[model samples]
Target: MTDFDLPEEFDEENIVSKTSIKRDMHKLQALGKRLTELKPNQLEKVPMSETLRKAIDESQRITQREATRRHMQYIGKLMRAEDAEAIQNAVDLFDASSKAFAQALHSLERWRDRLIEGGNETLSEYIHDNPNADIQHLRQLVRNAKKDLKNEKNTGASKKLFRYLRTIDDMDNETTP
Candidate 1:
C-alpha cells in the first residue's frame, strides 16, 4: 500500500528488460549519427509574392501562344488526312519559309534592343540643332526596316523557289509512273 510497494502479481524483470533497453538505445544513437553527418549548405529562401505569381502566369501564357503557332505550322505542312497531295510540296516549302521568317524575327530583337538604348536625349539633341534632322529618326529607322522586311517577303525570289520546288516534286511523282 506504500509508494515503493507493488502488487503481489507485479514482476520487475519483465517491466525493464535489458534487451529492450539496448534496442532503444541503439536506435537513438543511429538517428543522432545520421543527423550529424548531414550538413546542408546555406539556405537561400525567397518567398513567392503575388507579383511573382502574376509574372509567371504571364510568361506561361506567352509560351502557350507560341506553342499554338508552331502547332498550326506543323498541321499546315504534314497532316495528310486533311489530304491534298498536290499541295504537299507547297506546304513543305511554306514551312521552310515560315521558319526563316521566325529566325529573322529573332535577329530583329537585337535591333529593338539597339533602338531602346540609342533613343536617347544626347543623340536627339545633336540632331535637333540641325533643321534637316529630327528626333523621330529612331522611329523612322524602325519603320523603314519593317517595310524592307515586308517587301522581301513579297519578292519574286520566294515565288520562284516555290515554283522550282513544285517542278521537282512533279518530276518525282512522274518518274514512278
Candidate 2:
C-alpha cells in the first residue's frame, strides 16, 4: 500500500511566493500609509484572540490549508481545560436560576391577588349597608382599594374585604365614644 501523503496545497512552500526585493519596499510603504489612515476607534477594536491577527497575516504568505493548521495550533494553546469547564458550569447555573426566579414570582403574584380579591368583596358589602357612615372614612377606604384594584382586577373578594375592614374600624371608633 502507498503511504498517505498530504496534497501539495497543504504544504507552506507550495503557497508562499518569494517577494522580489524591489516589490518588498513598495509593499512596506503601502502598509505604512494604511496604518496612518486608521481612525482611533478602528485602532481600539480588540481581536477575539491575539494570535488570530498573526494567523491572518501569515495566511497572505502561506497556503490556506497551512494557515488554517497554524491558526488551530495557536488556538489550542490559548484555550484552557479549566476555563471550558467553568463556562459550562456558569451556563447551567444561569438556566436553573432564571427558572426558579420565574416560578417564585408566579407564586407570589397568586398570593397577592388572593389577598386583594378577598379585601375587595368584604369592603363593598360594608359600604352598601352603612349609607350614613362618615363620607371621609368611606372615601379613604375606597381610594386605597381603588389603587389595589388597579394593580389587580376588581373581584368580589377585594370589594368585600375593603368594605369589611373599614366598617369594622368605624364601628370600633363609634363604640369607643
Candidate 3:
C-alpha cells in the first residue's frame, strides 16, 4: 500500500497525524495573534525569541491585508520552534492580572457607591474592613460626595472618593502575600 494510505488497523502509538500538525500550527497562529494584541509593556513580560518579537512588531506596523496575513503565518512558523507552552503561560498570567485589576476597580466603585448612599454606616464598615484607612479623609470625601449628589453638581467629590478607594485597594494589595 502507498504511504499516504491508512492501514486497516491504525497504529495507536503514532498519534501525530497530518491533521494534528495542522491543528497545532493553527493554535500557534492564534497565540501569535494574541501576542500581537498585547501592549508594549505587556509584550515585554512574555518570553519569546528576538526573531519572533520583531516579527510581531512588524505585523503590528503592517497595514496591508495580504502582508499582515503573511507576517502572521511567519510568526506561526517561528512559534513552532520556540517554547510555546511558556509563552502561553505568560500570556495567561497577564490576562489573570488584568482581570484582577478590573475586579478590584469594580469593588472600589461598589464601596464608593455604598459610602455615598449609606453614609456613616458604610464608612464605619469600610474602616472596619481596612483598619489602616484614613477615617477623617474618607469621611470628608464621602460627605462632599453626598452633598454634590444632592445638589446635582459636578462629580469632583465622587472622583476624589474613587481615587481614595483605589489607594486603599493598592495598599491592601501591597500588604497581602
Query: What TM-score, over all chains together, does every model reach?
Result: 0.18, 0.19, 0.51
lDDT of 3 by residue, 1-177 (tens): 998898889887977989999999999999999999998977877789899999998887899999989888999999999999888866774575666456667788999999999957778889999976899998999999999999999869999999998878656644642
TM-score of 2: 0.19
lDDT per prediction? 0.39, 0.44, 0.86
- What local lDDT score does residue 125 receive in model 3, on the 0 to 100 scale? 85
Q: What are the per-residue Cα lDDT tens digits for candidate 1 across 109-162?
A: 443434334545534543453334333654455444445456665444333333
Candidate 2 segments exceeding 4 Å error: 1-97, 120-177
Best by lDDT: 3
Question: How many pairs in model 3 have backbone atoms within 3 A of each other, for residues 3 or more apart or on separate chains, i.e. clashes?
Answer: 0
Q: Is candidate 1 or candidate 3 better by lDDT?
A: 3
Clash count, predicted structure 2: 25
- Residue 165 displacement in candidate 2 (angstroms): 20
- Over the full model, what C-alpha lDDT does candidate 2 score relative to the true structure? 0.44
lDDT of 3: 0.86
Worst 10-residue stretch by lDDT in candidate 3? 93-102
